[model samples]
Target: MTRPGFSAVSVLGVCLLFTLSGCSGTPAPAPTTGSASATATATATASPSPTAPTSQAVTPSPTATAPPSSAPPSSAPAGPTETATPTAEPTFTGFPEQTGPLTIYYVAIGDNGVSGPMIGCGDSIVATTTAPVRFTDQVGPSLGTLLVNKSRDVGLSGLVNVLYQSNLTYVGGELVGSTINIYLSGQFMLGGVCDIPRAKAQLEYTAMAASGATSAQVFVDGRPIDEVLSLK
Candidate 1:
């Protein structure tokens, strides 16, 4: 039973077990090289996140620029900038009284440069009035209305109702034989003889009657009245 061959067999079995254990040792975890590769991949993923931040940073730039673009459109509505033209004089000059047996005849606007009827007002001068009536005096304080009222018997309307102030003034007169030169300053009315030839006829007749002149030459602002008015 105690054979010497038994110890030799036990020793052979022990050597076979040691060889199998060495072979199944998990190959030293493959030198842990795959873990290092996984870690590198994770680092690459983190690097790509930095690119995402760059993209995110650029997104805000467009948002900030959007407000500026919209702001210019808001200012576009401020367009209709125009200045108003002045149509009135600052201060009008004073009017003087009528001088020496002078008569001012008012001609209402009508057809053919002379209306249906004419109004001639004569005032006897105890002391000679100032030559040439002033704009203020001519249209002063309802004077035009009173003048219009005097011509009511002739069935004339809208003669004295000048809606706008006629920045007009009568200066001195120059008499050349039967032809008397009448001078006026500034504009008389918006219309002229061309528009209302009757009005011109009225004025001419009145001037001739007042100066006792056979003919009258009209001058406005030192220019011929014909030039200012489109006389027909």
Candidate 2:
């Protein structure tokens, strides 16, 4: 009643199992290596760190440059330039109390020279022995008024009004025949003229008049000259 050593049922079951395994054509899956897994884990961790490092910020140092100066502004210059100095005038000697008696002659010459008895340099009278004196106007206006035309005369006929004066020059103290001179000025109001210096001619003497006339008067140099010629 026991089955033979190789039972057909058992054998048929074993062959069927082998046939299914061959027809499925499946192989065993390979096991994962430890090194490969470790490499993969490192790569994943490094990739995530790339996005994280960009978060921090950087700064600069202290002690840079300095500022500008604190000084004030400037000022201006001062005043104008200056000029030069001036000059002075002239001088002469003094005079006497009275002039003594003297006789003078009048002479006629051509057109220009001294004319009657004139006083100059001192107290005496000096005679002009020439005709019409060509005189210089020394004061007032530079060129002055002419009282008379250039003409012939025995006496000085022009009248002069002294409007101003130069410094007084001294004619010496009077004696029997003291002589003197002067420089006068003139400007013509009535006529056109040039200036003349101590130019008028007259006779002067210290003799008392016989006609009860205290002062003497004479017609000379074409003018009536009234002069105190005496000490009476």
Candidate 3:
């Protein structure tokens, strides 16, 4: 029954090839180990491990402070104070004593010619005296002598005592510094206008010469001699 050019030997050879193929086991699948390792690496990169929460340290800010003062303390004690003193003033004394024959001035007539002709009327001269005198004791006595009337009887010719009729008597005298104060108590009488000058000159000049004073003033009845003598 081989028909048509096909032979039994060809058919047997084909069958033998198929049988050999069946006896060998199936081939192993391709390895996936590399793919699995790649997948695990990707997962690890995508999901990072949770990191522990970090703690922060806190630094406090610096506090402000006040500066100290340069002045001294108020509790200390104070120092002492000083005071001043004042000065004083000066005083006065008296004059020296003198003694000798005294000179007395009296009013004279015609001594000054027409300018002052009558004695005691602005005319005068030093009268003569034989009696020695002490200057200290003569001030009262000298003024007393001028009160005597009648100059011709005392050898003083042309000299007039205008105060003889006034009844003025010499009191005590005081020598103060260079001045002599002669006190008199009396009634003041002048025979006429000419008698006034004669009275003043006789009293004042006698007082000065007797006391050796630079000036003299007469006081009568506790008043100035000029006031009393000014009577009309």
Candidate 4:
């Protein structure tokens, strides 16, 4: 039991120092697992981000509308209706009265030295079935005998006197057997009785018509016209 150099106090000190050094050393960290990393990624994916505010679209309404045209404008006026005028009837004004009964033909000058018979209407100039006019009562100035009265009836207008003179006299007519004599007393003789053939023909025709004789004789100024004018 006798240990020489080793004392009890030295051994006890060395053992206390070794116990203090072991208590001061740090401990090792634990290892990470794959399940813990997957859990954290899923938590971030499931969470939703904040949403932006929604904008509403606004539609505008029309302001003006056009009017319909069923009729004409109010500024213009309508046209007037057309009407027809009535025609007037004719009236008889200046026509002469048709009196008497007989119609006889007498000679008168026409245009351009022409001569023809004109009608003379009288009561006693010529004979008719409805009215008989005695030749003795046929006297004085009348149409176709002395003066042309009804000129329009023979295609002439107004009064036309072939024997026109200032102071002429028609000395009546006389029937001497088959020959008829008509007398005249005036300076206004028809073409000197011979120089004018138209005048001679007119006198002869008038004389025949007046007396209704076969041969017509003319006497001017109490002398026979044939003897005065030297007519064959």
**Which is the leading candidate under TM-score?**
3
Candidates in order have lDDT scores of 0.49, 0.32, 0.69, 0.49
**Model 2: per-residue lDDT, tens digit, 1-232?**
9776978999999999999989897777766797778888988887765555655676667877746534333354333444656656555343323323222222222213444333332222233222222322211111121122233243463323221231222121122222322222222221111212222222122111111223332322323322211213
- Candidate 4 residue 131 Cα shift, in angstroms, is 13
The worst-scoring run of ten residues by lDDT in candidate 1 lies at: 120-129
Candidate 4 — what's its lDDT? 0.49
lDDT of 3 by residue, 179-201 (tens): 98989987877678776776777
Write candidate 1's Cα lDDT for 1-232 as tens digits. 8665657779999999999999987765454788989988999988865433344444344434443332235545556657999888778454456434333333343322343343222211111122344342332222232223323233333343221334555565666999977776767554432333433444455566555578877777888877776544
Q: Using TM-score as the measure, name the better of candidate 2 and candidate 3.
A: 3
> Which of the predicted structures, 1 or 3, would earn the higher TM-score when compared with the native?
3
Total residue pair clashes for candidate 1: 5
Q: Write model 4 residue lDDT over 65-98, tens digit each, in one string.
A: 8476655666775455457797788885733434
Off by over 4 Å in 4: 1-135, 139-144, 147-162, 165-167, 189-195, 227-232
Q: Where does candidate 4 have its weakest 10-residue lDDT segment?
A: 121-130
Cα RMSD of predicted structure 4: 25.6
On the 0 to 100 scale, the lDDT of residue 109 in model 4 is: 34
lDDT for model 1 comes to 0.49
